[model samples]
Target chain A: MQDIYEDILRLAAGKIRQRIRAGDYASHTAGLGKGKLQANIAVMPERYALDFMRFCQRNPKPCPLVGVSDSGNPNMFTLGQDVDIRTDVPSYFLYEHGTFSREIHDITTLWQSDFVAFALGCSFTFEHALMRAGFSLWHIENDKTVPMFRSNIETVAAGPFSGPMVVSMRAINKSRIQEVIAISRKFPLAHGAPVHWGDPSEIGIKNIDTPDWGDASPVTDDQVPVFWACGVTPQVAIEQARLPICITHKPGYMLITDVDDDAEIPVIAHSNS
Target chain B: MQDIYEDILRLAAGKIRQRIRAGDYASHTAGLGKGKLQANIAVMPERYALDFMRFCQRNPKPCPLVGVSDSGNPNMFTLGQDVDIRTDVPSYFLYEHGTFSREIHDITTLWQSDFVAFALGCSFTFEHALMRAGFSLWHIENDKTVPMFRSNIETVAAGPFSGPMVVSMRAINKSRIQEVIAISRKFPLAHGAPVHWGDPSEIGIKNIDTPDWGDASPVTDDQVPVFWACGVTPQVAIEQARLPICITHKPGYMLITDVDDDAEIPVIAHSNS
Candidate 1:
């Protein structure tokens, strides 16, 4: 078989949408597209559009927005030319009255005329940058989800969307802290920089053995549990709002976007490039 | 006359609320409480709270938030021992339908059950810091409001609150840009750090002489027109929302809180203290 990333990249977004639409691919999308950008998707009613947009606005550390769609449009033209939200992600969680009802591969059957789709910046993009800068990602190496925890930090509230912030924890050797900070600061949209570093108790994380989401990793005496605002925060807020209907990408089955990783990096452009 | 600041601080938050409740003081409160933390105020309807909060979040460089209230509460106890939204500000602007209508000293008569008050970090706090750091402020020396302009930089929008960012312009000698940045960053809540320094047109001010708000200052040949996100952006957003009744501190008049200025400086606290 061809390299998974190359095969995935060659596959048109529409084909990916079709596979997801067909309920054939339900696995998380880690290391699938190599350099391609994957996004966290939030689908909500138009009535919640502004407030939800604000929630992402105030909570950019976790919800750096990549693109916002016009009302009821399934096509996220900005993210990809032929992107259709209803059939994009491999799996999605449907929330009704704030309770998880079931999982589905496609939302085409549930599409609403007043729905708005928001594609948020994800930490996965910066993980590549960190790797390029020589920082090892244990989660990718182990094929496990990044450990995430609910922090004591309160998100600036938006209407119907208020909850504790969710942050992803990474164990980094004490010596590499400055390098990680320097490398991550360059990608502000990808949860920008770590929100909290060192003693987990300081940010309200009680146990390292368990996490709010994803698999937990152990921290050695010389390692610090560095935490960055996670993109999953909006999903938690959506659950709390208890809106009539809400949909979000399944944990790691993100919406692959055409927005190039280099384009999103914040450094000044070189003239020759 | 006795120092106005001493009188204001001597009045407990409850007594000040009583005076504001009685409509006794109807003037700007700048320089009225030398050691206390004063904040720019914005009160909006519950429906617009989330987007407005996001606006502050997205544009923290210009709109550092100090305190946010629960829906329907005029009491900003988090800010002080007994701060009351209905009466503390020396002056308030009442906007209906997103247009300025009238200025008043208190909102006791127009208080709504769903109103939420946000106390923003103000420039005055950082201005005090800048002065202490040995930098000169032209507006303070000449007794005029800081020059403000509507920048071409569009604020990261959340919901119904989307518009150009407004910036307060200050002239600093070329040698002092780094010093200003170091000093100003200590008050992130008070519009920490300059957004742009050097060229006025770079951020999209066409004619630097004519400002969108406040008076203009002459930039000497060696001085740069440094810009910081202004608190006025929220005022502009509230006007844009056009809610039936929105209130904010009248330009220059602020709400004095029991917060000690020395206590709130962003410096890491000394272990012994």
Candidate 2:
């Protein structure tokens, strides 16, 4: 019998995932799937799924859930009918009880009946929107990875998950700050508006140049360092959780989804009867 | 050690729950706890929780999550530091295998080790916003309940939950409909914007006078029937799922929460480290 993911993935996102799955296009996905949603992937056991789900719900900016695969199911039906969580991302990071273990391109060898896959919104969507509006990203222009930092902002914790939020830093010209805020705020699912913009010290970032992850994009005198919640924030919480085992996408290699970035995703209802 | 649901509830929401907790307030929560958030409650076993949570996530317009009680433990710490899910709401309807088994004011005796409680956003927040803005709601002025109906629109399914959307209707003057929409959009947690307005038939409502639930509020010549997704939509899906047991707040009985109607509600992130 034909599976649900048969036809839809042949386009942009599907083609990208196919390459990643075949180990052909194994680089970062920034600017890959134009106008399509890219997501940060997290896979874990069912027991921790609910708490993690709660954590995501509570911390939506950093963890806007695009789709959650059913326990034991590899197909991310809603995300892309043809996508499989196990092989779609370019690479995966295995975390064993909060400690980094190894990286692999495919989890087909480790698929488990109890695994639940979480696809979280990535800033690439809003970044695309920013560039479209004439805001040139420094890192994108320099061909450097976006700089990320650990902030003092404490996220509301759920069971086994609690920690300071990690944020992605970008230098926006001071005069266009409001316009950037307005543009980014439109995609709440894509980490939304910047959590901290002017002072890194306010969010407890002692040094602006030394990012905990990715390449540092220096803030010039003409610009202020704007920070948006990063997808890596969940990894911090997931680390604190120290689950027996957890899987996440390596920093820039996200799961490209067929879903549109600006679609008015239909919310649903129940009959009073 | 004192529990989390402490001094905070001494305010309006806290006091109201105290009444409902003591069986002092068993009536509908409408017009109560002004400026505070109210939620619809759903309780089921852990085995069914992930799917149910997905159902709510998929059908967010009718099921904007307010708080989800940790599995087994009854404290809805997020909703109220001190609220007990088993006894806080004024009344609950116990559904056994999709059948309305009975009504009860407390579920303490039936609480199980695997029970998970769900608190969903209610339209009252938007209604309160509408009322505060000086736009008189037909039902509020007449002291009638907001009318609800089963629409032909089907909800996106998750696991075992699937069904048509149910919506609550209000008569908005043609001139004020736009204003009402703008006001409600600000409260995304409270069902956000209206799904439909003007002609009821567009959404598959065959009759203008008869509603599936609540009191009928007529739309006059200058008014249009504005329909917002109703909280009852989950119950419709829950009914179809037919789990061994399920519990929900009776139509009008809701969980009054301490959260402000309009707040930034910070979203979260993780550290790459």
Candidate 3:
């Protein structure tokens, strides 16, 4: 049964990639690529690569770097054998001088010799872990995007990269908060544990209903709003930096990788050797 | 008696700072300013501040940044109201193009308008915590420096900064390992928890008895050699980066701060507001 499940996952990923490559699927990837690691993609010129890498390093919770492609390389060999950055994602957003330029299906025409692509870990992996642990996520069940807010937290500044941390919220029962923390803490790549819980006002969120991004889910009286560092944080930083040109995956349209969702994403500290 | 203890701490820090400022005390800071936080200081030109900040952010376990001074500011008001980066530390080491230049008592004359000072958390705070928790550290008991080695562990590289992680070792009884972890994990600024334990060979330490830096501590049959991320890791990276001029506190001559030794060093993730 396990072998059959693995086969099904491979076929799903392959078929999804094909559809995305052929410009047939161009939408958010929230529920697709189940049991696989999905990544938020950021593409920029080689000149900003070093600083951007530093930015991601300093802000690992929001921008957990999964794989970084070498200059001009669209193939993320580390992420997968045949992963192509330009077309594997369902949608892409282009930003010029920190301003939104346009949304496109593919960036093959814009790919440059000096371009570098960064694949950051998304919250989907931990969300899967939470589900496996018998915790229900309202956003997924209700078919709504996870609500994200710009928090008052300031990220450690890197060169031309500094902004308020963005967080995604999920309403979890107060009793199961400890269980959620224990499960999510294991996936450091997926933003680790909740950064804030209980009080939205503490993190500068004035209204829980009105999210800066994504649709809000109902927060019951028994539930406390739990927040995790959002992958959109790097996007906020990039916009604040106002680089000449930057590209990112459109919201929810992530690049699904060959990595298993349950695989332990190695923390940076232990990988020094 | 409690008020008197606090008074003594204030007097002790002031006297030590005065002696160091006047060049009366020019040596390692070990065993000095007990119960107060001591910081490892790094000073560099503002040009490299952003990159260096990113480097510290990326490799946080090794370079747990406690405080960062504004550009051209020698006064680290965040660490201490009267803290002056130029002369408060007992001794200073100057490096040029990654080469050691000279050990000096003061850097007032060499201070540049573009210079930014960064104060990193040191292991001393955790060591004190360990000792208070009734764990006997062999190096401290024997009045020897803590054993530090270059590990196979690679720090997340940022800009021109990248090197093998340096770790400080303490021999702790196998039975007390959990207690040590619980105590040390509380001090994130002080390189929290052991990165590796038991086998030195696992982290590529060729000779446990001969550390790359500091004196070797004896590992008894019942005790395991527990390693924690060392502040020296940043010095190694700075050497590799080969910046024009980088300044750091001399070994053991840390800058004692006003922060309480046992106070919680807040994690960056929850501090958005």
Best prediction by lDDT: 2
Better model by DockQ: candidate 1 vs candidate 2: 2
Candidate 1 C-alpha lDDT tens digits along B1-273: 245445755665445656665676556666656766778888888777756765665566667666666667777755665667787787888888888889877688799888878888788888998898888899999988888999988766656776778999999999989999878866656877788888788999998888888988888999988999888887777777677878888888887776666543211111000
lDDT by residue (B74-98, candidate 2, tens digit) is: 8876666478888888899999999
In angstroms, give how far residue A37 of model 1 lies from its true place: 7.9
State which candidate has the highest DockQ.
2
RMSD of each: 6.7, 6.2, 5.9
Write the candidate numbers in order of decreasing TM-score.
Answer: 2, 3, 1
Q: What's the CA RMSD of model 2 in angstroms?
A: 6.2
- Candidate 1 at residue A229, lDDT? 87
DockQ of each: 0.08, 0.25, 0.13
DockQ, candidate 1, vs. native dimer? 0.08
Which residue runs of candidate 3 sit more than 4 Å off their true CA positions?
A1-41, A45-90, A104-121, A125-129, A150-165, A177-207, A255-273, B1-39, B45-90, B113-121, B125-129, B151-164, B175-195, B199-207, B255-273
Evaluation by lDDT, superior candidate among 2 and 3: 2
Ranking by lDDT: 2, 3, 1
What would you estimate as the lDDT of candidate 2? 0.82
* lDDT, candidate 1, A19-116, per-residue tens: 65676566677665556678889898988876686566456678776666667878776566567889878888999999998998889999999988
Question: Ten consecutive residues with minimal summed lDDT in candidate 2 chain B?
Answer: B264-273
